[model samples]
Target: MRHATYNVNGIRARLPRLLEWLEREKPDIVCLQELKCADESLPIADIEAAGYGAVWHGQKGFNGVAILARGDAPKLRRVGLPGDPDDSHSRYIEAEVGDYVVASLYLPNGNPVGTEKFDYKLKWMERLGSHARVLLAEERPTVLAGDWNVVPEDRDVFSAKATRHDALLQPETRAAYRTIVHQGWTDALRALHPGEDKLYTFWDYTAGCWQRDAGFRIDHLLCSPEAADRLRGAGVDKWARDQEKASDHAPAWVELV
Candidate 1:
């Protein structure tokens, strides 16, 4: 089975590109982030027409997430992280698909070093870590895929110096993400292509980042041991990112036997 994660940026605006990718790649399941649409506004009909059934957690003009299964709708598992009741952003959602449990998440981009947003980003990561432990304990085939918003190491980015002040490369952010992977979840792409630098899943629209290949690896598919044992391949769908008016992110995927 093939599982993919993409941060579409905005679902309504990217619908055409999305359908085009669906037809081309035909991933068995896909986790989408940054939908930036209201619940009632989800283009359910259009997605269904493209042969995918989806379960989404949407926020009007900001964060949102969803899981799409090739045929039937994925069985809803949960929405939002469990630890914070006041955290109302629609940034996390999970579902049961086939024999595996999958989750789609959009981690907070806590920009500017000393601010509440950065604090919130740290706290939210802590919550994610706690829940990840529970999922790991379940001992089932599972995949936690999303735009993690963390640059794991200097090698993962084009130039760490360029993004030195960015929150994604911050020590706290990297540590939080590291804490999760240490719990036995495999970082799919890295595992498959070790030592390959400049492997990226996203690029900024400004500064000709895409043209210059100044990008980083943020979107990831962390697999549990059961799933990792069957890993066949993994890569970024760069073709999707080259389209006209493409999203800043490209789909990153994993294939399991």
Candidate 2:
């Protein structure tokens, strides 16, 4: 089976490229983030026409997530993280696709640190860690796929100093992310390419970042032990990011048996 994750940036704005990608890759299961559209506004018709069945959690003009199955409709597992009742960012959605349980998440980008947003990012990661523990206990094959928005190590980013002040590199944020991974989820991409330093998944649209090849590996696929056993290959579809009207992120994928 093939699994992939992509943050579309805005589904409506990137429909053409998205459809093009769907046609090209034909992955078995796909996790999508940053739909940035309300539920009622999701382009279900367009997506369905591309031969995929989808379930999505959407918020108007902001964060959203979805799961797409190539032929079968994903059985909805959950909509939002269980820890926070008042949190309503539409950033998480999980489902069952074939034999695997998959989740698509858009972790908050706590820009301009030292603020309420930064605090929320940390809190959210804690919540994610708590839920991830539960998922691990289930012992089912699963993949936690999404735009994590946290750069795990200095090696994952092109220049730590360039993004040193960003929330993604903050000590607390990295610790929170590590807490979840320490629960035994395998970082699929890193697992396959352990020593690859420049395998980045995202690039900023500004500051000639893409042009200068300045990017980071923020999007990820965390596979449970059950699923990791099936992992055969993993990589970033860098060509997608090089396209016109592309999201800052490219699809990170894994092939499993």
Off by over 4 Å in 2: none
The ten-residue window of minimal lDDT in model 1 covers 111-120
Q: For candidate 1, lDDT tens digit of each residue in 68-175?
A: 999878999999999889988999999999889999999999988789989989999999999999999999999999999999999989999978999999999999
Q: Show where candidate 1 strays beyond 4 Å.
A: none
How many residue-pair clashes does candidate 1 contain? 0
Task: Please provide TM-scores, in order, for all candidate models, with all chains considered together.
Answer: 0.99, 0.99
Clashing pairs in 1: none
lDDT of each: 0.95, 0.94
Between which residue pairs do clashes occur in model 2?
none
User: Number of clashing residue pairs in every model?
Assistant: 0, 0
